[model samples]
Target: MTLLPEFITENGEHIRLMLVDYFPRLVTAIVILIVGIYAIRVIKRIVQKIMVQRQFEPTLSKFLADIMIWALRILLFVVFISKLGVETSAFVAILGAGGLAIGLSLQGSMSNFAGGMLIIVFKPFRVGDTIEAQGVIGTVSEIQIFVTKLTTGNNQTIFIPNGALSNNTIINYSMAGTRRADLLFAVAYDADLKRTKEIIQSVLTSNNKVLKNPEPAVVVNDLTDNSVRLAIRPWATNADYGTMVSEVLESIKLELMQAGIETQPFVKESSKK
Candidate 1:
């Protein structure tokens, strides 16, 4: 590139020189754009590789990979524009002002994004983990930037916002090796406690899915009105919860009734309000 000096005619002999010419400036701008895009792509790949090595959650890994790439790209884009003779000071000032306004307006959304990021980073639950969160009980299918997906036992898909999950308590059932099924079925107070225990033991043994290693326990947990509240606490795998809940209910109801033991009323109504 060469610089040429030109004089303004009919004016007071003032001379001006343009350095580096126009073509070289254009080339420099183009190179900056290329390098910025390439750098972001390379950084994204590196992040993805690191995440894979760390065994991060699959859903989260992809999200992080994409976010990293986009963030770098946006920064590079701003730099590229600045290099291309754009007045970045004023542009950046305007962007900052607009960003603050948007942040205030979408405060809740930002919170959810932060929550989702926490979930991804800390990983309280993962795919296939049965968890109770935001008052919904289901298996986590996927965890994303904005929401966590759940598949209910009935095969219903539920999308829960990330903000609500972080704020509320989350019951992760799969964290422990074994879970106790604290089933409370009250028998009439007059019924023989010994006979009821025997009947429950038999029912538990009959179910093949019940684990024998932990040893199931049948004991009187509480004494309710008109009944003896017996809790059938059994240890089972997370996968066994659904089957246990259903099988225990059916088997206990039938076996207890056959043994002439009456079940207690869940909600007994009185004449008065």
Candidate 2:
């Protein structure tokens, strides 16, 4: 019965020593973690602000900011673990091995990530630009870390992998600011070619959307057995191109009809048989 009190006292002393030795380390690690997290947030906000002031692409800015935050978080974790007396070299080696394994498993994804970095840096096309790539024509809606999203004219959304996008030919329609619309109208073979050309030219010039600098052109494109194909070329800003084409086509049809010019549809030699 005398030994029981001594045993309890020894155990209590051991626990007190353990707490005295480890509690401060624990508290210090937690404080460091809290402060580090707050610092990371502040740094991220500052980086974002700097990028914005420098006119960086929003997608690129956000991506870079996230990468910086994650890297800092990883560094802070290493510090935190080291403070708890855990060996960092082994942990870092394990992390490296795991990263290598993940990288090997996601070769395609890594390629896409590289391509995305290339895009963010080179900036061949920006968000809201109309581009034709990989047999898809649409306005770029978003540029993500792995893919670029497009909104088509028909209101369809497409996700294109960045790896293929960077490697492929990209026709950026919006970059030129102005687009030449090639419109073809067929009229009867016996129609007054001069009057038809004049009518088409008049229709193009009357539209406010058309650029006067380039000057609209109406040329005889081809002569079919049944009709003469008139090619009308008009330069308009990208935003106005679609509307101008539709309006000019309708106007030309009306003007030709009023002038007693008969419009004809082109018939292929095989179809004529």
Candidate 3:
């Protein structure tokens, strides 16, 4: 018991010496970690401000700023751990292995994350932009890190994977201030082309939503087996596209009927091949 007591006294002294030697390093590391975290936040905000000044997409800017912060924090943590005398190379290797495991387990998720980054960087489309993608035409409500939300014309909400959206072709209809409304009308083969053109042109001109700058066009598009197809194209503001097109179609039909234009039996018996 006396020997045990003596041994304990010596071991306790050694323990005290170890603490005296390591305590400063521990405190230094903790201080650096806290300071580094604060610095990272400041840097992130600075980056975000710069991006905003550059007119970068808001979603992309914020996402990239967060990535920058997390990456810096990770690097700072490694430095702090190294300052405490931990082998950084082995720690990095372990981190790499863990990351690889996570990556494998969440391959789809990683793909989405990477795709989201690409979208935010390239900015093919933006939130609130009307887009046609993946067989759905809708207004983009939000651009998230993993998915994009769309509000369809029918008021249905669609959640599209960022991976798919990045890979697919997105038609950004709202990118341009104005959109061309293309209307196709099938008329009787015997219909007077001159009269039809005049009628449609008059209707297009009367609609206040149609822009006169680019000018509306009514042309004989194609002579199909059943009828002569007339293409009526008018330019309108993005917000007025859907309503203007619907109004134009209805107005044209009413005008043609009032002018004694016949739509049924488009190909007369004598005109059919």
**Model 1, 30-121: lDDT tens per residue?**
89999888777788788888998877877778877876777777677678777777778887788799989999999888898888988877
**Per-model CA lDDT versus the true structure:** 0.78, 0.87, 0.84
Cα lDDT tens digits, model 3, 232-273, are 888899888778887888898899899988764432111100
Evaluate model 1: give its lDDT.
0.78
TM-score of 1: 0.76
lDDT of 3 at 101: 97
User: Which runs in model 1 stand beyond 4 Å of their true positions?
Assistant: 1-30, 55-63, 81-87, 257-273
Better of 1 and 3 by TM-score: 3
Q: Which residue pairs collide in model 3, if any?
A: none
Candidate 2: tens digits of C-alpha lDDT, residues 72-156: 9999999999998888999899999999999999999989988888887788998999999999899999999899999999899
Residues forming the 10-long window of minimal summed lDDT in candidate 1: 264-273
Full candidate order by TM-score, most accurate first: 3, 2, 1
Deviating ranges (above 4 Å) for candidate 3: 1-27, 55-62, 265-273
Off by over 4 Å in 2: 1-35, 54-60, 83-85, 266-273
RMSD of each: 6.0, 5.0, 5.0
- Give the 10-residue window scoring lowest on summed lDDT in candidate 2: 264-273
